[model samples]
Target: MGINTTKLKRGFRELFGKTVQAFIVQLRMETGLMLIENTDLSISEIVYRVEYSYPASFTQAIRNHYGKTPQALRCLA
Candidate 1:
């Protein structure tokens, strides 16, 4: 089955609560995956494109959530 945008919107509303930081972090997670899966840009470029002020913080968050480095995930595809 595929995700519907309506369901996805509702899901995000429920999961992210009302905190702007939580919402932005979730957005970063999604954007990071899109960058890794769909583009040839390096991880640093992805970090900047996502508006993360600290590359190390973004890298750590990505690693903590996905259990893999961006470089490692790139190799999987």
Candidate 2:
């Protein structure tokens, strides 16, 4: 926590092979996917749970990451 912004970014990128933003998006998308697959929660609820402000954005993220819509993914599950 004491590190400067540049140093923190560098260290994080070196350790994680991606920027902090990418890592966070990856975590959110993964969590969203899990919820979609295993829970009965609605798409809007899942978007809120994943910290997205809009269902459309969350759906776009899911599509970008998995090449499937949330509903499509849920159907597979």
Candidate 3:
């Protein structure tokens, strides 16, 4: 697209009610949660599947979004 970066950011936020980064993080977290809940994949595997290079960072993001660790969420599922 020929859209300016600033204008794209503005339009994205206006349309989604969140910054693009936040939206991406949210998508990653949601994917991670779905995997945790429905699959037998390990936490580290899920982390990588969500494009996170560091399991610690992915764990922290999950905790922040779901108030639980991936393992904890998996146990619940």
Give candidate 1's TM-score.
0.71
Report the lDDT tens digits of candidate 1 across residue range 20-69.
56788888898998899899998889999998888898888899989988
**Candidate 1 Cα lDDT to native:** 0.85
Q: TM-scores of the models, in the given order?
A: 0.71, 0.96, 0.95
- Evaluation by TM-score, superior candidate among 1 and 2: 2
Which pairs of residues collide in candidate 1?
none
User: lDDT at 4 for candidate 3?
Assistant: 96
Q: Write the per-residue lDDT of candidate 3 for residues 24-77, one digit (tens) a residue.
A: 998998899999999988888998999999999998989999999888889899
Candidate 1, residue 37: the lDDT equals 85
Cα-based lDDT for every prediction: 0.85, 0.97, 0.93
Q: What is the Cα-based TM-score of model 2?
A: 0.96
Per-residue lDDT of candidate 2, residues 1-77 (tens digit): 78899999999999999999999999999999999999999999999999999999999999999999999999999
The local distance difference test score of model 3 is 0.93
Error of 2 at 54 (Å): 0.4
Please give the TM-score that candidate 3 achieves against the real structure: 0.95
Which ranges in model 3 have alpha carbons more than 4 Å from their true place?
none
